[model samples]
Target: MASSQPNMERFLREWRQDALNKAQYESAIFIGDKLLAMTNDDNDAFFLAQVHFAAGNYTRAQALLAKQDLLTSNPSCRYLAAHCLIKQNNFVEALAILGEHTPTHLFATNAKRKTTRGVRAATARANSKTSSRHHDQGDDIPEEDILNRRYEASMCYLRGLCYAKQNAFDRAKEAYKDALRIDVQCFEAFSQLVKNSLMSPDEEDEFMQSLAFNSIRAPGDDPDMEDEPADYVQMLYQTQLSKYHNPQAFNTAIESLSTHYGLENNADILLAKADLLYTQCRFKDALAITESILMDDKYNFAVYPIHLACLYELRKTNVLFLIAHELADTHPDEPCTWLAVGVYYFTTGKIADARRYFSKASMMDANFGPAWIGFAHTFAAEGEHDQAVTAYSTAARLFTGTHLPQVFLGMQNHAMNNMTAAEEFLKTAYSLCKTDPLLLNEMGIVLYHQDRLKEAVKMFASALKIAAETDSDPHAWLGARTNLGHALRRLRKYDEALEEFDQVLRDGGKDAQIFCAKGLIYLDKERPEEAVQVLHEALAIHPQDPIATELLNKALEESAEAGDIGLLGTADAAFGGETSEEGGMSGDLASFEQRLGEKKFAARMKLARGRRTAAEMPGQSGGVKDKGKGVARSGRRGAVGGTRLFRGDQEGVDSMELSD
Candidate 1:
């Protein structure tokens, strides 16, 4: 039986790999059950538990493991049990189980020892020029050591996942490092580490260089030429880390991975690269990859959603409908399929259809955060503010770590003129996702409206700093620069403001709004001719802009009256002139008539000031009459180049025409 153990294990391993194949689940489970019944061996339970776990029967897997003393039995039982708990979001229980069974300090020490041993083995193997057996022995880890390392790495990886879910990023980073140290090929740990912001670029490059070069180490060859196919999963992680920040580097990594592991052999890496392309808005490239994957595996549910998303974004309606129908027919019961369709509808501005599909997905799985967010988005689109707020609140609660819900909530509240509520939500969103410049821009807008000029300037400046640091999102960078110019202008910092506006123009921001801001600055400086030139440029782009038209009128008037003696009348007309129905102006005219002399102009101005003061007294009929006229005139056209609504990247919000 002891000699037969190796053969039995090899057969079991082969069978297990086949059984876990998603397409072969039912047949494999039936055969596994049959084998379990025929075997009286101590390992029968573990094998059966693996079958159940792979078949998505988490409870059954846990029950089988519960029958054994998991601490003394194969460590795999505890690892699998913890995985089941994590899948169900029972993270607290999973963490407790990991803490009880795993020794952190001991594992750390063992990891260092393993690294030392590998180095020593390599040196010894190199020294033995006569023996190939030495090389073979040097590369092999003892079975017990292999099991220990596997157990420790799995435990630490799961621990990292739990911490990440709770938004404890610092702890998550430490946990990922521990897992990588224990098992050098732990691709999951490497992927999560890159996903987090804890690693600086220099540190990430160093780590990535080491992983990519050592991905495959051969007996006696240069590290670069050609190495064995060590897992390409780590390469996927490297591409993920640089996917947005450095697309050239990401493409290079992906090409290398594809070359090492042929595209046909590594579907997950292909899908990952395709997803990265999709995120970078390279929809055509992503669609090509997804199409290729579909040709080989039509029922690959994961690839179908991505294919549809690419199709929708690319406006490939003919293919999009075909794929959507196929996906619905193939995976009708899967909530994610419904969620994907809903998100597609949402993206396309079909709110009614989006809501219907989102609701269906929510009914299928109440915990699905994207479906709930989709539902909230529909409510927001329809201007049902209260309902939208409620739905967004639910989404925020469900997906605590994601910034989308809070960002949308802040935008919605800000749109509705609820500045206090908007700022609160934006602050929470900033806390959740500090690196997003868009959130900072929104916060700055809120502060700008609240009359906190200094605070708004700081917010915009901070957003600009982050945008420059990231250097990937051009829209965020340009928008923040524009907002910074506006903030500086409000603070009366003309020189700094002009520099910002000029920088934006140099960076290809030939926007009508930027021109209007610059023109306003010239108007404030009384440089009417310069103002006229700038305003004409703004009007050429946006003729209906009310504020630009008003400023242009003022500039024209100032230019015409370049040396006018009727400055008093011009000033009075510019600042709310007297209404013909009111008697205040008649009283002022009578006083001016009474002061006729050589110094009549100066004396009439003094008497006009007294009459104006008398007319503006509290509770006076003249004041009441003036207030009524001002209120009546100040209607829809009152907001002259006033605060712009915070329209995020979403479409349809800027539909209102800019007019008086």
Candidate 2:
């Protein structure tokens, strides 16, 4: 039997391999059952349970393990059963099995510890217990004084784990300290003490000293045993150091781990250090570490994800392409890696490539929300507004609590000239996520477009307040201020509006929108010269901006008619010194004269000004009365079929003229 044991082991391993590779859950479970019947070994039964667990046949695994009575007889089997119970979230059952196991059984001990922590965490959650109060209690001493003191210390350690899982750091630290006082060599208590201390900066030095002492005392120690504890302590130090914007501590922790343990023994520690760098936006350092890992072992697939993330963060387009190509070759079946590749293409303006990769990701993971969103964004970039909206709506339906699809839908509706729909989507989004300054700003812009100037002002003001409160990016605050200026200008608060625009420009926001908005305010004030100068400046920034182009032309025509040759010359010089004599408007004042028809223009201007003032001062009955008389005059012009200026559709006037 001993001579045949090697062959039997090989056969069992091969069978396990074949079982693991089965595609269908039913097929895998059937194979697992056959293997269980063929073998009486506890390890073999555990492997069979693992197959059933992986195949989502948890009920079958539980029944099989129960029939074998392995949950009590074999520690490994008990650990596997506990894990399956955890997967099913049967925390009580899992904890029961875990409590019966001994910590000297490494695999079972780890599982038991994890399950016990989870059970305690679930209990705390169900009772709505606060962490501070729940974790502070010492071990419940029995009334019988005959209980062993070592048993009490073990209980204290278990309680410490309960507190650790609840994130009650202070109490967990005290519990671990109590355990240490009872038994100084309790590795579990020492490990928990290190973890809890690192979470609080005030206890970091003490934890470090404890760790140093333990590492020195353990002779011929299993490197794996120290690996997890050391790595955990290092992770805590890295986290706490990150709060202070220090990246060097992460490197130092990695160095210490490498010096104490061989490189192969600390692969996870290296990976964790790289992850910390990535979190700090140090993509270059992360990439370097990942590359080093890859060079040492080309088959290290775990490093690929980190490498992809680092490349994407650094905007290393060339490296991203290389990584994607390599990942596609090596990991063709993994949807998440493909999705990362697709996102890279999407962000870098390669919509077609993005669509292809997103399609592949969707094929791999049909329920992937990001792939669907990316597909919709690709269509949106192509100006296929209807298709984009449909795709976005589908994505939105598939995933709840995601604001991206809603935001994109709002943008699509806005682009389609559907103000009402756009405003509705934006408002819904705002209600869902009130803290999102971007949503608030979008809603304000939509309100402004609908001629709800007062509401628009309020919305923009709300966004600005939120931005200030949250310390949002300067660009976002600047955009809100710019929009607020336009809303204020529409309300005829000219001075206040100008102040907002000035602030935006002072903040280095030289976008054409700001320039055109300022120019429009000047034009409304009948300061055509200033309007011309401002509009010319706007065109210099963005010559093809429709608003700026139209406003500039209007300013030039008005200036030429007023015999302001200096202004005309300034405009001509601004436009590459092409004077009106060279087939420009100076030689064709007749066209301008014919368009203006001064009498009608002056009457329209006066009526427009009165209407604007009346709109701004809503409750001023006397001013409204005067504006009503002007409207009556404007109405007579309409009745006489003259130009019907100051129409109720003044907001649509620009569109109508542009169409003509």
| Candidates' C-alpha lDDT | 0.55, 0.51
Predicted candidate 2 versus true structure: per-residue lDDT over 107-145, tens digit per residue: 101111211111121112324322232111112334232
lDDT for each residue of candidate 1 in 514-570, tens digit (9 for 90 to 100): 776787666444466787898898899899866577667777876666446444324
Per-residue error for 262 in candidate 1, Å, reads 6.8
lDDT of model 1 at position 138? 16
TM agreement with the true structure for every prediction: 0.60, 0.47
lDDT at 385 for candidate 2?
70
* lDDT leader: 1
